[model samples]
Target: MLPALSTLAAPAPALSTANTGFVLICSALVMLMTPALAFFYGGMVRVKSTLNMLMMSFISIGIVTVLWVLYGFSIAFGTDFGSVVGWSGEYVGLSGIGLTELWDGYTIPVYVFAVFQLMFAVITPALISGALADRVKFTAWALFVALWATVVYFPVAHWVWGAGGWLFEMGVIDFAGGTAVHVNAGAAALGVIWVIGRRIGFGKDPMRPHSLPLVMLGAGLLWFGWFGFNAGSWLGNDDGVGAVMFVNTQVATAAAMLAWLAYEKIRHGAFTTLGAASGAVAGLVAITPAGGSCSPLGALAIGAIAGVLCAMAVGLKYRFGYDDSLDVVGVHLVGGVAGSLLVGFFATGGVQSEARGLFYGGGLEQLGKQAIGVFSVLAYSLVVSALLALVLDRTMGMRVDEEVEISGIDQDEHAETAYDFSGAGGGAGSRRAVPAPDGLPATPGGPASAGRPAPDSTGTDNATGTAPHPKVDA
Candidate 1:
């Protein structure tokens, strides 16, 4: 009977080609975020390993994109087996479900939804790499990511998004993946830092960012792509509803940016570019779960709240001795929770299709559901992520050998360099970098230049440079 009904299902039955086009565009926009993430994270690392860090995000695109087609979608959105997870039957091997899919009355091509979701899969785990930067064997890290996707990410995703998943059955309202994406990834980053341990010379040295503009650039791209993330959740531009989400996304992001900078200036005595970027991310994270649920004003409040809370999260490691080096845990996990629970309190005023939070007098029911969603993802992610880290550590080791640790991964792992402006010259490699476009000699550690190159094992030029990029260690 199921097979007979499946044959009767029409192609593109629930939506039109026009709607599929919109979803396709949105999915593409989300895919761009991985590269944007590359710039955001790449610029933060020492020049020696910039490519290596950026590669992490890129590899995710390669690995998870394939996995999603194979069974990731099944594991996540398939029919529920009992009450805990799905049966992998909704669209086996991407069969039966094609150009027509009814995610609701508003449907699109199944492939459109599949491709759109694949981008999310690629990015979530990639975010964790920032925590254990500048160390860990590449091969070990690669295998670890694969294992992690199946063991940790898939099951949790099932619980949150799958029809049969317990969280979904309980009516947890995570419109854009608060628990599934941000909280899950953020908590896992914490687990990674725990198992991988600190970077070499962590506290002993200044450990400053190598670039600021790169950070800003990344933030800019993420900001642009986020329109797709928030607005596209509706699957089309067919109505004022999606337009509202788009506007709310921008307003909330701006509010969060302001809040982050305000707090930082008051606490640190300077308005930092990095802080601004991170604040934008915090706003984006906070609004994600609440995007479909909040009014513009409520979104503004949510963004502001997230910024302040996440700003405080950055200081957690210093106070508690846990090394969430990049604060993935601090910002995403914390901000996502703030948005997730708070939405229950503020879902009033033009948010009917949305759930109401307790603050608006909805009482404890929604809040309790939100809390359960957060803790379940947090607990499951933390435990599974820790086990993966341990497996990598126990089997092939986590951190690289001590001597390799001292050298950058680009040199040791990739056997390459980021910049080669000098090219082989006069039978000896010239260590001198090119002059600035303004005809000024590049200065190491200079304001206009990437941080000065550290002396190499052989004292050659271009050895251990801190290229200006957008990365901030927590």
Candidate 2:
């Protein structure tokens, strides 16, 4: 056996079935977050704009998937191009990957890693849609998703996670995507809203969420899917890091929710369901970047701080005069910054990497690195996203007509409505009077009412006779 030198050479690495399966499942969970986002944003807008808000998130799935298969993957994870971007002909269309080819040093196949990362790319641009609800045209929004993913998301992703990227090479830690996903999307949201201007009846109108239940459902699902999002970034469970990330994610979220509710009680008068849901999401966002690096207690601190900060930040739209329709900037941008920066103080230096945070005796060096990652991504996304919005506004007109803005965007944009009172009269179709038992008067005081008094233009059910709920300050 020793006679032949070829026989002694090391063989290729074999795939780890366990790691591959784990990553694949995580990919599916992350994919579910997109539709969940649709539900979250859909419930926050007025009845007229519900479907449009949903479509904004739904359309990103289609646009980003196609782009990822073509060149998005390459631009994000391909061979590095001078630290600014990545490029590799083999990664284009994923044609060069093989069945057994593992992802560099990892045991899972390259295809598995590519698809898992794809889910992250899909949801990034969708996060921006919450700010532009009820205003932007469907076609224009779709085009913006494609362009933004190409220009902003892909490049920023490379800078954070891709091999040889500047931020990655510089040792700025981001276990998941606090800086890359949340901050990037939040800054972009601010930029787009600035260009498109405020929603109709911005300050004067009492705009309220049409459905809080839907918002809660979406938040719940996002919490579930995020386990996969945060844990899967480690690529495998061979080490205990993924398990630690999972635990930190849960602890931080719970702490953040409690902290937010406490703030709401003191500042606002009562603890609203909307506040609870928003607080939970704030915790999730804050934990995303620092979860892997911090201990459970550290995660709790980060989550609590982010929760209070975001709760206060949401009111800034009114003070500063920017229409962030759904508090994307408050919860995501502020939460992300809070989480990314906190890593400098909370990182244990024993979990994901050896780098210690300030509390762990590493001093300000790591904190400075984190700051560099945060501001660079924020400044770049804000400037580039605004420029893209400006170009789109000039070319095809970003906003719907003013008349359409007043009358429900769902009907005009998608030709469908979220609900129909046409049949409120008690039949499947036809709102005409039912003849009222041999044509006698159906109602005591009036001839058979027309479909139980359809909702007025203000979207309040006429039958209830109660004024619409006052808009929450959030």
Candidate 3:
């Protein structure tokens, strides 16, 4: 058995070099997921909004990391308060947590654990960015992240994983973050979008993803990083549970990808790259909570189900008339709910926890518990997120001007473009703007027009008909 933590000024306890090293590596891997998410969401937006999409996810790393170091970590993992929330001020600035202090029952230092969980805190809010893509203000988004992380994420994290958390006490089986991460973010996405309303051209425009290759690349990164996210939650390398979770993750993802393709082939008559990427993510989200609790076959069932369901769910935004720009609500929220609840029927006592599902003769008890956890988080996140968005919308405004949106958010918000049509990269002096065969205006933020000396500060070339930055009218 491990020894109790030593008192202040005492020599640090001997560390488990293996577990410590493993968690550190896993922490680094998890950190990579936020940027991976940026790419995943970035590739889905139009060229004009591409960088803004990337920024929405990238900024979470900055905002949440600072908050985590201050009180985010403390509220999540600090002393518990009635199991409803942790004391946010107790570990203010991580004051009492020492560098050498070992986390209970783990070989890693408390600081390492804090940082690892911090990665989760960072990405949870970022997940909502995709649903609001193309229309929201960057400043408003940054502020929302700060507020949501403090108000929603930190407290929820405590309920799920913090010592003495209510859900932990109630025996809810969230191996990773089926509830805290995916469901919470998914519900929150739905709420914010409701308050922000639909995108300007919703339904009328095609709004296809700008770059599928980037989407594929982002999906690949998410798959690679998810191994760390799921298995790393074990907090050590000593047990077989991490390996089980790792393999479960792989099998479930493959099954979901194939299942999604099959469903698409039947419904849409063709398999697309976007479908494959979305299916893979659906699988990843589904198995996150159930990975350690089920067998390989159980993982397959979970993945296939999520793939089929989420593909269908994505269309709900259009049919129901609510815009979830990037399907964050469809994939993460729906898939998360499926995974968490399904575990109640598939969980095996012999795998990770002693809990057995109905299929294994454990009956409906566990399933009831799972439902309570899922809906509670879903309802709470949905209500609170909408309130936050409404407050922001009323005060400083949450969306960009219509003119700026039409011209492209990247150029207007960031004062830069993702692509330059000027042929400047290939050594060609300049290019003239040419209208597309569609007879629409040249893409406002598209490649530069030829025969123009250069774009002026306003992002337009007067010599040619190219307008990189269209004028925004009040």
Candidate 4:
């Protein structure tokens, strides 16, 4: 008995270390998503704020990195003080918490676990910027990011994943981050759009994308990294990696593509490149929470549902008159809802234990739990994000000067340009204009470069056709 107690007290090797390693790898993959996101979003906007577009993503990496290290994780994953928040008991300043593992039946480094989790923390807010693109001020955005992460993101994360977390106790299975990351981010995107108001020109402008190839490249990278994002959520590599998740990702995306194109064919009469990208992303979002939970056929149905819903929901901004410039609210939010709710019905067996869905005879219990969790998270995130946005808007202001906006925030704010390809400035300071993310310039009829030569702006263009400047909001 004495020997047994001693052995038990000696502390088994940290299972969460393996958890940490896998998480660390997945986290790095998720971090790669930010740059991938930069290209994705950058390609969707006008050429004027191309650098600013990229900066929004890069800034989140910076802002959330600091905040997460500080107290973001504490408030998020610390011991629960109540259902709404976590206490500041562990991982503060990277102290005592790393000595023990954070997961069960895995031997991974605790610090590794923290860092892997940290990567997820960094990307969530960046995903919301899709809506408020091209107008928000840099300093205001930074402050808003800090506050949003703390007040909104932290609490919600706590409720879902932290010890004594309500959602965990309630038996809701997230798999990855359907309600926590995507849904929460989506709702916040809507709230921020409401608070910040529309862009300088809303429906009146012909804001076309400047570079389709760049957008596609970003999508490709996201696809590659997402294998890590979803499969890695299992906390360790397993035989399942090459099985259900891999197939589900493919079929769901394919189904969504078909659904979107068919919808466009019936409604708009043309399958625009933008529509294709949006559809693919919609499927990806819907599949996130259901990665390993349901059968491929179920995933297909979920993808079809999400593709149709998100494609339609995107128009809500226009009808409602909010300027979510990039549709973060539409795709991520709507798709997240569809995925999470569908999994509740379509799950193969038990609650987080792969509870069967409605069609699978799991009854309404799981579905009800899913609905409760989704709306609760949505409401919580919307309220917190709105309050944070208003705080920043009132205190420091959220938009740039109108004149600066017209001239382009890159020139007005960052004082540097993204392209110098043509030697337009001659010596050092002159530059040129660029195409929008999906646009290609008609250079004397040869296959056009996406960047058009601006008479006086920075004449820099990346390998893609974009002529961007590395300017954040000012």
Task: Name the candidate that leads on TM-score.
Answer: 2
TM-score of 4: 0.85
Tell me the lDDT of model 3 at 432. Answer: 40
CA lDDT, every model vs. true structure: 0.75, 0.87, 0.85, 0.75
What TM-score against the true fold does each predicted structure earn? 0.86, 0.90, 0.88, 0.85
> Cα RMSD for candidate 3?
8.0
**Model 2: clashing residue pairs?**
none
Report the alpha-carbon TM-score of model 3 versus the true structure. 0.88
lDDT of 2 by residue, 99-218 (tens): 888998898999999999999999999999988877889999999999999999999999999999999999999999999999999999999999999988776665667888998999
- Of candidates 2 and 1, the better by TM-score: 2
Lowest-sum lDDT 10-residue window in model 3: 459-468
Ranking by TM-score: 2, 3, 1, 4
**What does the lDDT come to for candidate 2?**
0.87
The candidate, 2 or 3, that scores higher on lDDT is 2
Q: For model 2, what is the error of residue 342's alpha carbon versus the real structure, in angstroms, after optimal superposition?
A: 0.4
Of 3 and 4, the candidate ranking higher by TM-score:
3
Extract clashing residue pairs from model 3.
Answer: 421-447, 421-448, 431-449, 431-450, 432-449, 432-450, 433-449
